[model samples]
Target: MEKVTREEEIDEIEKIRMTLGAHLEELRRRVVYSIIAIVLCFVFCWFFKVQILDIAKKPHRFAMGKAGLSSELQVLSYQEGFYAYMKLCFITSVFIAYPFVIYQIWQFVRAGLYKKEKKYILLFLPISYLAFVVGGVFGYFLLIPFGLQFLIGILGPGIQPIITMQQYVSFVFMLTVALGLVFQLPLVMLLLSKIGIVSPDKFIAWRKYAILVIFIIAAIVTPPDPFTQTMTAVPMIILYELGILIARPTKKGFILLGTAVGCGAIAVVGVYFYFTHRGGEINVSNPYGDIQILYPGDRGWKKVSGHMSFQKGITLKTGKGGRTVLSTKKGVNVGMDTNTEAHFFDSWKMQLKTGQILISMKESEIPLEVDTPNGRIRMNKGTLNIQAKDIVTIVTAVNGEATLLIEGEEKKLLEGRQHKMSIGGEPVDIGAIINWSEGIVTKSDEQK
Candidate 1:
């Protein structure tokens, strides 16, 4: 009997060793597959590395343009650009190969899971990739643009920023990857719940603690600024709430999740329409002395009061000693000076028939086109003063940049500079040009 027991023990030991060896082999195969995917992606990405770099540089360029600075990334050393390009291509490869790599990992691990466990994993595999992509898109579109704008332009103007290629690339890559990983909060919770480790009730009970930890993580992941940290933490808190909702595996939980998702989709659609449509009108405020608007087909100009809106093809006129402001949904602010006459062609284009107009754009992606008798001025993002007379047009770039086209000639106007159409360009005092618009105050400005 003792010999029989010894033989059984030996058999059990040999079976366990064989199982372990098989698992190791599977892991090796998965690793090889992942490496091959990454290598293939890297080679493809390397050929278009310049275009990738340009895409990465877009946010930085936008921030610099908004801040009225040059949009050039500096290189500290000769080899720095080469290494940065390599790193950039590698990061791009990882991003492209992430789904395939996850699939390889999933294949290796699925064999060890029970039927129920495998079902849950399979359900979450695509969802995990989708969440990661959403996180990356959020970082790229919203966070990077606004975060870099705040960070780079927080000091105001007059300070030139010399961001190095290595540092910039590292910052962007780290932030993107961190956000992508952080977005896995809900999946982690679902997995824990499926495994009987933690329940939805526990997640709800620990909400306060989780929020605290989320803020801490946001502070670590984002730049050391309240704006960026708050932006990151808010989304994390929302994800935490979502995790709690998803942790419940009952029918009621699914119904609640569906309702919440439906509401979110409606809200997003509503916001999109609000910005894109905006009733095809520009808002008017800060009517001082006398400000009047003439509709597209109106024969007479009507006096404007506290707040009003003008449709396209309407003409706005300011009497002597009068000033007012026109604002669009796209962040274009047009301040009409005393005795100014301008025609509101549309949301993005205006015709300055005569007098001076002060235009201040706040992070507007759409270009503002102002037509004058002498030339046409096009600016995507800037603060400038335009004076149109009978034969000549004067443009003073108080902040940011502008482009002037006249008589088949195009000129670039930089900040703190003045360009007289048909004449030339020269440096000017921004304060002098923008001082008149200071007196025109809207309710929001008054509250400020």
Candidate 2:
């Protein structure tokens, strides 16, 4: 009996070893194939490095032209350009070989998942690829241009902006890859929700915090400007909300309809605001020195002195030792200090392009919205001091109550509270609001 038991144990051990060996062989084979595919793609992309590089430089050139700066990009080292070219080819190869890599990964893991779960691979692969491509296109077309323009424009004409080939390529690669990963937010959430790891209700409840986090991420990743941060954050917020919609298990049809309608309404509103406000009249008053306005759909800057009504969507840039006051007919007052850049989206919405702006508004049926790099503030009959600097936004509610909306959540600020919000972290209380807004002028009591 003992001999029979020993033989059986030996046979079991042999079977287990064989299975492990087979799995190892399979993994090795898949890895080799993936490597071969990547190498082949790399060689192919290397041949078209010139064309790829040129395509990547388009946004930089466009931004430079818009800023009235030179279109030339420099190379600091002898091997810098060559290394950049290699980096470009490597990234392009990864993109081209992504499908094969995903396939190999799926093959290696397919046996571990249930038969029902395995079927999801077919659905996930193509959608994942499409998401990456969409994100890459967005980064290239919108994010890069807006980021470059804001960063360059903020120099205040004191410095000539010149970028290096290596730096620019590195920036492009990071932005595209980061956005590609970010675009996976919806898919990841759906997967987690399906697995019972996350639920729709939880996401909905966390929406406000999520939006705040998204803006913080945008501020950390992109340039320190409201426009650039907004361009990056809005899409992420939309995707996050969509993820919540997908996570819900009931009323799929209704949810889809509601999402579509909501999206359409937002699109319509955005388009209406963009077209009507684009090049519409704005009143600019310079208290001292000259003010330059970069009009919408125009690359060049227009000089303005004293009171002038220029088109909306124009960025008001104040010269050194210059102070400007801007007001719309709709009762919005903006006081800009020297070297400040501001953009009036409309009477209801305005963005502090750069520097500090003292905003005072009268009590009205509609609340005024001010967008900063950190988040958005909505208020009625309030005085708020908003300042945007590198990676930080300081907001002080001098008087009246104001709501700071981030990630869909609203935090109410009292008259004397000051909030200092940064890109990579939560808002911190930095003492009393009076300390920051003491001498600054605001609307009178009658205005409130």
Candidate 3:
């Protein structure tokens, strides 16, 4: 009887050893599959980069203004635009194909876990997806809007808001992703605690420490500003506290003691970077490198090396000689009187409804002409001759000065201002053409 019992025990021990060995092989196989999938997905994303860029820019096109209002503006350098959009594409491809990735991970880990644990983890798959989506939603719908509005509102008056498509898109996406990951804290804690990694008592004891760190994180994630930083920080702190509760293990101690404190400190540093500008006093510079069209709602900018001439908008129109209408508009509205010189011609043609107007001035080089049916604007500079007659006209300047000629005679309009001198023209009581480049300034929610 003793010998029979000994043989049975040996058999049972061997069975257990073989199970573990089998599990390890399964794990290796699944990991290999996951790596292969990611590589394939990344390669695919690279091939279709242009298509990916269009999607990433969708949010900016919608939020910046109406689609017909302006052309898409890229905030980064030429290289930056190419790379940033690629990064966006890679991230999106990974996310969209994440389910397959997760499934591969599960197949490897599944066999090692008991049936009950496997079932429970399977539930986590969907929950993880939900958490990610929720995080992104919180960022796009809530955090970004508030932050953007706050930055713009601060500009108040005397500023032209020129936000680039690249900057705008990147900023919104960053906030969305950061907030989404932050929202997944509870799930992360639950998993860690369930695995005997962290104990409940340890979490309760370190609650205060976690609270301090949460504020720090909030500061880092938000755009730098008292209103935005504090708002972002508070929620993060709350989430951290919630994380502790979720992670609390009744029997064991905490595991990520350092991670908790470290992430918190990082948050604070990020917030600090956001708010303080030019010795901690706020001054607006172009966030879009050399482009100075930063609107009132944007955050303070770093001192860019040089000026950025942001392409606010571009329009191709068919006129007598062909008009290239551009601004933050589909086309610029020009107004002029036949008697007006370059000075009066340079005055921005008011949207006439909104207080805003278009300022147009000529360059000394690129040859151009201005003529319309309204009154007319006459200007003379260098080798240019500007003439208008039929009705009132708005003049668009390229890079030359026009010799002002009115009613078959000649007169001095005014001198040309340097820069892409876009000044408003005077509109008749008849009204201004609703061109693409101008609008009445309006305040957004964050500014409020």
Measured with C-alpha atoms, the lDDT of residue 317 in candidate 3 is 15
| Position 145, candidate 2: lDDT | 73
Question: For all candidates, what are the clash counts?
Answer: 0, 6, 65
Model 2 over residues 279-333: C-alpha lDDT tens digits? Answer: 4235776568867877544578977766666433457888888888888766778
TM-score of decoy 2: 0.54
Candidate 3 Cα outliers beyond 4 Å, as residue runs: 1-32, 39-55, 58-63, 66-71, 75-78, 114-116, 158-170, 238-448
Error of 3 at 344 (Å): 17
- Residue 235 CA error for candidate 3 (Å)? 3.7
Model 1 residue 343 CA deviation in Å: 26
| Candidate number achieving the greatest lDDT relative to the actual structure | 1
* Candidate 3 TM-score, C-alpha based: 0.49
Query: Weakest 10 consecutive residues, lDDT, candidate 2?
Result: 272-281
Rank by TM-score (best first): 1, 2, 3
The candidate 3 region of ten consecutive residues with least summed lDDT is: 343-352
Task: Give the per-residue lDDT of model 3 (tens digit) for 344-419.
Answer: 1111221111111123444323222343333233332332223332333333334344443345554444334321
- RMSD of each predicted structure: 17.1, 20.8, 18.3
Candidate order by decreasing lDDT: 1, 2, 3
lDDT of candidate 2 at residue 217, scale 0 to 100 = 91
